[model samples]
Target: MNDDLHLRIILISPPADVDFGLQSGSGNKYKTVQKQVSGNGDLLFVLSVKIKNDKDGNIDFAGPFVQGSKGERFIYIDIGTYAGNPESEWGRRLKIPLRDIPVSVIEKLQPDNKLILETRVPGMGKDGGPNCATVKPFEGWHAVPV
Candidate 1:
């Protein structure tokens, strides 16, 4: 069994031609490509992460992963300003914390298991301000067999 965690992070109907990526707590990053979504939109990314555990038995990862203190462990996602250029002044960074996740879901996490995280990027353009991009979980998080 592959102990590494498989993450399927999907962005539904993001702003056209914008860039997106996955960022770790160590500052490493992976840029996402615009892939065709079934609904005439784009899917941001589906990344694989190596699972690590802290001394306190909390879940952690090796690279480009961030887990908060005992109360707020999370995964970080970055939204770039443009499709090709990730360094735009208008880019945004979002987080998906592990809080509120059911214990049953965590218990189901085994080697090679896949976790699906779907979110929608809201208020991209328009009067939405510089920090306008707010990420909300679209369908919540799911853990499934690989």
Candidate 2:
């Protein structure tokens, strides 16, 4: 495995003003992106390698992250549904763990590469399932040519 492999998680136009962050393996928290918003009216979360999965595949990530604890890796997506509505009240700030993403999808990523993602929040679909945020590599999603 390459030591510099990284994946960028970009949310394409979320439905609400949401905040995102990261919790490291040491139980330290860091505010990554405030009110996830891309210039094109979307949210972007760049994936960085915090710790390499050992033989145990213990994920040292927590708090709104998608990482695998097993041998496989994952991408975590956490969204804050501060819409102040009933449906949005219960599942507010859902911790979505994308455990099914194939490692090959991002295994070849280099420092300059990016993995564009598309998701359906508060709905059931690809990447994640019902009543949770879903994220999947955009069809034909590949490492950006460097």
Worst 10 residues of 2 by lDDT: 23-32
Off by over 4 Å in 1: 1-3, 26-40, 49-63, 81-89, 111-134, 137-139
Provide the global lDDT of candidate 2 against the true structure. Answer: 0.39
- Per residue, candidate 2 scores C-alpha lDDT tens digits across 65-98 of 4345553444444334332222332233333344
Candidate 2: segments with Cα more than 4 A from true spot: 22-40, 50-66, 81-141
The TM-scores, one per candidate, come to 0.57, 0.46
TM-score of 1: 0.57
Evaluated with TM-score, which candidate comes out highest? 1
**Candidate 1 backbone collisions, by pair:** 24-64, 24-65, 25-65
